[model samples]
Target: MGLSYEELMDKQQWLADELTKSIKAEFNKQNIVIANGIGRNRDGALDFSLSISDLDNPDQSPDVELIDFAKAKMKELVPDSDANVVGVPTPKQF
Candidate 1:
């Protein structure tokens, strides 16, 4: 019993929503703003950015938690797909 295309899409959307919630929660708890942008580059590679306002303060930094959340969500959404978390630079050190 394989999942239908629509079912797969729905599952993907659910996973995305779950990830977004986790991201928002972390940002709120850390009193930081996260700017998220998703798109495909000229080379056809999917690019997503998660920008945090502060980076130096451990309590306000979201990098490690974001990476962990992404990794867990990726595994849940696509068990066989290869997904890796890429860290991005923040605007300033807290």
Candidate 2:
């Protein structure tokens, strides 16, 4: 059975918090930020999207290694959770 709405929401928050912690630990020196959101996919499944960016250089995208690390951590953190996790590149903000 799939997770209920409340469970999904909790999972979303948990995933976001964990990802944020992992990134901070791995890139302590850089002023990095993580933007995360929860939404439903076409199939009605809960999906989580995480964006990583650096404030020092907003134009530059996060390194591929960092993205990979987040992806891996997401899998390890919730291997069988009912939420789909996506790592998106942070866009430059004005």
Candidate 3:
């Protein structure tokens, strides 16, 4: 049998939460925070379009340096996985 809607939602949330934590934890900075994610891709890996909050300056747009740092860190974390880090945030998924 297939999973219920609630079950699926829970699973999705759980995955998202774990992904967020893992990503955030790898980033050893205090100014970044997780905003939201568009859920994982249907592909073979745990891909998601993520957003992050810039604690130092949340109102302004994302800095290019910050985004690059995020992408690099992500690559380091999941180098072999097919999980692509879609969006690095204008500032908001920790």
Candidate 4:
């Protein structure tokens, strides 16, 4: 049988908590800023972005390795979750 509403909610909360902890640990280990955001345009299109940077030195932004690390952690926490990144270009030199 499929999960009940309550079961689904509990799973979601658990996933959130797990993801939060994983993210925090990564941030502390790498001393990076994980910038995340979500929004919808007037045309009803959804948009989101996730990026990382060295908190100790804003000029030292994160690279693909860091982004991939975060994405992997997120996927580990929520096996079925999907994340997409659009046109926002990654800094060429981080």
Candidate 5:
């Protein structure tokens, strides 16, 4: 049976938290934010996207190795999710 929308969202949230913790453990100084979403891809398969951003240092370049590591770890956590990681600027706070 397919997971309900809420269950998928919960899983996404859990994955995000796990990724955040894992990354932070290695890169303690960086302000890392891991945002994730679960949705269907073009082929209608379950897919996910993880956005890893440094909120405090947007100008500084992100570490490619770190992103790759995060992607790998995310994939290990959810084998079914075709997870993609991208760097995005932090939204301006009001």
Candidate 6:
């Protein structure tokens, strides 16, 4: 059976919080500024879309690369949870 609504909400919250912290750390390390972000837990995975603007041009596309460390960190933090930072490097994405 699928998870109940309450269970899903709790999982979503936990995943978002954890993922946000990880990504935010990465952004800070790279001096990237985030304008907006959205997180969702679906299909038993945590995913997010973050709008980060470049340090040179805050109004333009920001560097949005989650470091390799972040991926390893997520796995360590949530051994069984499938957490991922989803972003496509393209003009349309920005």
Point to the candidate with the largest lDDT. 5
What residue pairs clash in candidate 2, if any at all?
none
Query: Model 1, residue 90: what's the lDDT?
Result: 54
lDDT of 1 by residue, 9-88 (tens): 45544555556666567555433344444444334444333344334443444567666766676567556433334445
For each candidate in the order shown, give its overall lDDT on alpha carbons: 0.50, 0.67, 0.49, 0.48, 0.74, 0.46
Residue 32 of model 6: what lDDT?
Answer: 41
lDDT of 2 by residue, 35-54 (tens): 76666644677656567776
Residues forming the 10-long window of minimal summed lDDT in candidate 3 = 80-89
Stretches > 4 Å off in candidate 6: 1-8, 29-67, 89-94
TM-score on alpha carbons, each prediction: 0.39, 0.68, 0.45, 0.44, 0.74, 0.38
Over 1-94, each residue of candidate 3 has an lDDT whose tens digit, in order, gives 3333454445444544554565456555556655433334446333434465556565664566655655565555434333334433343457
Off by more than 4 A, model 2: 1-4, 40-44, 81-94
lDDT of 1: 0.50
Clashing pairs in 4: none
Ranking by TM-score: 5, 2, 3, 4, 1, 6
Cα deviation of 78, candidate 2, in Å:
1.2
Clashing pairs in 6: 53-62, 54-62
Model 3 TM-score, 2 decimals = 0.45
Off by over 4 Å in 5: 1-7, 40-44, 92-94
Native-to-model Cα distance after best TM-score fit, residue 28 in candidate 6, in Å: 1.1
Regions of model 4 farther than 4 Å from truth: 1-30, 39-48, 85-94
Error of 2 at 51 (Å): 1.6
Residue runs of model 3 more than 4 Å from their true location after superposition: 1-29, 36-46, 80-94
Candidate 4 lDDT over 1-94, as tens digits, reads: 2333444445654544454466568656444434455433234344333445555554554556556666677666544445442213334564
Q: Tens digits of per-residue lDDT for model 6 on 1-94?
A: 3434455455555554565566666555444433223344456543433333334443444333453444565566545544444433324333
Clashes of 5: 0
